[model samples]
Target: MTTWEPKSDLHHYLRVAREALLWKLDGLSEYDIRRPRTPTGTNLLGLIKHVATVESGYFGNVFGRPFAEPLPWLDDDAEPDADLWATADESREEIIGLYHRVWAHADATIDALALDAAGEVPWWPEERRRVTLHRILIHVISETNRHAGHADIVRELLDGAAGLRADHDNLAPGDQAWWEERRLRLEQVAQAAGQSEPRP
Candidate 1:
């Protein structure tokens, strides 16, 4: 039998998402990790950087427990989306290290507070700014998982690697030739559907 501790369960899932996102960077060159893969400039390293900043704010400042380290890129005067991309001077190790530190800090906050502990989001609209630890945990977990999904797609686009995790890809078994045939079949079906008359 397993005891269901809600907080612990949420934390476990959050860590899963974090690890999945970071794993996307493994075995990739610096250029590959940092290069913009999407038209909107989404990249693997940038995704990690952006989420670190987000977790720092939500788990740190939101609960009146600010993360000790200063993040100049997150400052008000800094350029927009400064946290989204790492500059040439910012090595991959630094960004990854910072995220690990953030995990420690956030875990502390989660440990020290109860699910119902009161907190306030300074940036949220006044009426809804007040929140509980449970709410914040759910919020951050959702955010982390969302970025992890993005990481999965971006990593696949980069190197043809796609999976839910290193050990378990959670994908149907298929070789490259099988996948190619499947893709062609889907494309043909899509074209046929496009040619069908509207059902209005």
Candidate 2:
């Protein structure tokens, strides 16, 4: 919960969150980043790759910075989930480099546009061409944070370790046993109501 207004200057907070999301992959092996974190194999590196490609598209292609890279998933002939997971051949550095490039292009777009500056979304319906930087900023921030939350859960599932970082803030440090009992009570309440468990 932040008290700061998410305005034109809000890029700082959004950028921090985005970086934190990427930092989740730090110290992880190439295998770790590519390993299945979910039934659908939502690995950490894959999520970063997806976000990088998407950020490049929305902020780059939309605004015309146009990041040039050979994205296999972008190919019409490739698997739809290609960007969703890493192949054995892909290295961690390669994916990270791609993400950094995408970010650079995205940042360039942001630097060029004012909050009120208007542009067009080419893929939208014909009547929806005109859009403001404010809208794009909001959309990208929402998209990044949404995906990052997925990353958070996936990372925690990968290891019992959790939090935005791997350290001091991970534990609540207050009546955790009581909290655990309360959680179990909530689970019993839910089970009594015919629910299996809480969703996320």
Candidate 3:
């Protein structure tokens, strides 16, 4: 019989979200990974970079255990959203490598502290600045999974590749034709519903 561990379970889910986000970049060319997919300029590589910076801060500085490398992009004087998009000079490997390092640093922090260990969020409002490892873990996991969800859509928009994971897509089993038919059916329903609505 396996004993239930809350921290272990949380860490496992966090790792799952992290891997899913990174998996979105696999098998894509540099341009595809870095090109802006949305009007606001969201991209695969940028998502990874942004999450890395986020983890580095929440897990690193929040716990008084800063990540070794300096992140100039996160500095106040830096251009807004600097961490959200990689420049031409930043290679895919570099961004991915940084994420891996951040994961290691974050994992170390998790291992070192108890779930109830106290920490401070310097950037948060004063009343809410005080936190615990458990709270931070939940926050980081939520943030990572939220961005992973973004990667899912951006990746599908780029290449029609969509899934919760490579191994198990977590989608209904259907061929391309089946999916197209389903989409057309849904579109018809949407149009019908719209027409039935009373617009002022």
Candidate 4:
């Protein structure tokens, strides 16, 4: 049995979220990983890049422990949404490498600070800028998991792959034909309900 402390538990969940997000990039080509799969231009590599920036800011800058690397995407003169996509010059390896570095930085912050250690989010509204390590941990975990969910959908769109993690899928057991039938059945039910509704 493994004994778990409060901070360890939080870090555990955050790590899981991080792994899930990175898993979405596995078995994908450079083009496929960088290609926008949604109307709003969401991509797997882009999501990872965005989360890296998010983690660096929240864990590093907010705590006055700045990341060593220069971030042109986050510069004051940079174009909008610069952090949300990878340019042609940015290789998959480079982006993923940066994300790994960010994970290390964030982990160091978690290990060094107490849960109640104080910090300030300068980018946040002034009234709500003050925060603690515990609050930032929870916030980053939520944000990372939210992006992981988005990655799940985006990966499914790319290659029909969907799972909660590498080992456990957490999906209903069904073959392709069974899934098609399920979809049709749901569509029929929805159509029947629609037909029964009175005209507005």
Candidate 5:
């Protein structure tokens, strides 16, 4: 067996989380991918756009290695949360392409810096801005995976599709009918429990 390296393991998890978020966009049309399915305006393509900007900022500007590309959405004059959604002119391919490039940029930072390499997050408070490569990697990995989980729910709401990945679903074994029955059973239990509750 190969020896475990902290950096390599962290990178692997980060990549996995990135892929999981991207996979939610698979087989979706421009309209569907851009459609906000939740009250919070969560959408597949928007999530991709958001994460791209997120990675670019965290790995680029935070580390003093800024991305060459100009992110208009992240500009000082831009509206708040502009990076959270795609505009009309921004095609799906364009956003996805940007995300891929961001991944490469982030990977380059990870590759070049040692785990102990120091950096500062300019946007963060002064007292807590200083950080190391190891801390950033863990933070980004956690952030990416959190968005991936949101994407999973958004995709499920869109088409009832849910899984950890293409190869492994990690869901309990059940046919469509079985799953429906399970849902009904849960609803019944919930209703019964609600009825038994004493008046407040």
Candidate 6:
């Protein structure tokens, strides 16, 4: 086997983290991928969807090379929560493909700009004038991983899976009965904690 090297100043950590986030969603069904992990309805597919939009926005649109796509969740008039939970009719293949394309756009942003190349985010305060591709890469990587953790939980709640990274196959070995036992114990503990009152 041969070791790989990064082709540019885009940095290795950023590249690996980006690939890792996309890898986490592999082999999941649309319904399986879209179930809300929290009471707020954060999910795996929706996370990827949001990343695609934001990446394309920051890297493509902000730089004046707008990506060509009809992103409905990004509609400013729509409720913000709508972007966090996917609606029905979002095909797994389509969303995943869009993410792949967004990666291309983000990569181009990296390639075309120097580490110190400056940018101004119009949405931010005017005092914040300059930014760098290197910094943006780091920010997006952190953002992706942050939401990816939420994805991991959503996956576990849907099917009892947990890990910072899972390579397509389910490494969890316990049977459903074992999981049920653990889950019930957790629920009981949570309930007891919720009802406990402060000492007077």
Instruction: Name the best candidate (by TM-score).
Output: 3
Cα lDDT over the full model 2: 0.77
RMSD of 1: 1.3
Pairs in clash, predicted candidate 6: 156-161
Q: How would you order the candidates by lDDT, starting with the best?
A: 3, 4, 1, 5, 2, 6
User: Residue 188 of model 3: what lDDT?
Assistant: 100
Off by over 4 Å in 6: 1-10, 166-198
RMSD of each: 1.3, 4.6, 0.8, 1.3, 1.1, 4.4
Candidate 4, 1-200: lDDT as tens digits: 97879999999999999999999999999999998999999999999999999999999999999999999999899989999899999999999999999999999999999999999999899999999999999999999999999999999999999999999999999999998899999999999999999998
What is candidate 5's lDDT per residue for 1-200, written digit by digit as tens? 99999999999999999998999999988888988988878888989999999999889998889988999998899998888789889999899999999999999999999999999998889999999999999999999999999999999988999999998889999999998999999999999999999989
> By summed lDDT, which 10 consecutive residues of candidate 3 come out lowest?
70-79
Model 6, span 1-200: residue lDDT tens: 96653335345665665666666667777777877768777788888788777788778766666788778776789887565656787787887888888888778777787766666667767776456665666676778778767676677678765665555444466777987898899999998997895766
Question: Least accurate stretch of 10 residues (summed lDDT) in model 1?
Answer: 191-200
Q: What is the TM-score of each predicted model, taking all chains together?
A: 0.97, 0.81, 0.98, 0.96, 0.96, 0.75
Candidate with the greatest lDDT versus the true structure: 3
By TM-score, is 5 or 6 better? 5
Clashes of 3: 0
> On residues 1-200, what C-alpha lDDT tens digit does candidate 2 reach at each position?
85754564657756876887787887777777788877787889888888887787788667665778768788889888788777788788888888888888777788787878777779788887778777888787888888888888887777644666544445565475876788799998978887655667
| lDDT (C-alpha) at residue 159 in model 2 | 64
lDDT of 1 by residue, 1-200 (tens): 99999989988988998998899999999999998999999998989999999999999999999999999997889999989899999999999999999999999999999999899999999999999989999999899889999898899899999999899999999999999999999999999998895977
Work out how many backbone clashes candidate 2 has.
Answer: 0
Q: What is the lDDT of residue 98 in candidate 3?
A: 99
* Position 196, candidate 1: lDDT: 100
lDDT of 3 by residue, 1-200 (tens): 99999999999999999999999999999999998999999999999999999999999989899999999997779999999999999999999999999999999999999999999999999999999999999999999999999999999999999999989899999999999999999999999999999999
Estimate candidate 1's alpha-carbon lDDT, on a 0 to 1 scale.
0.93
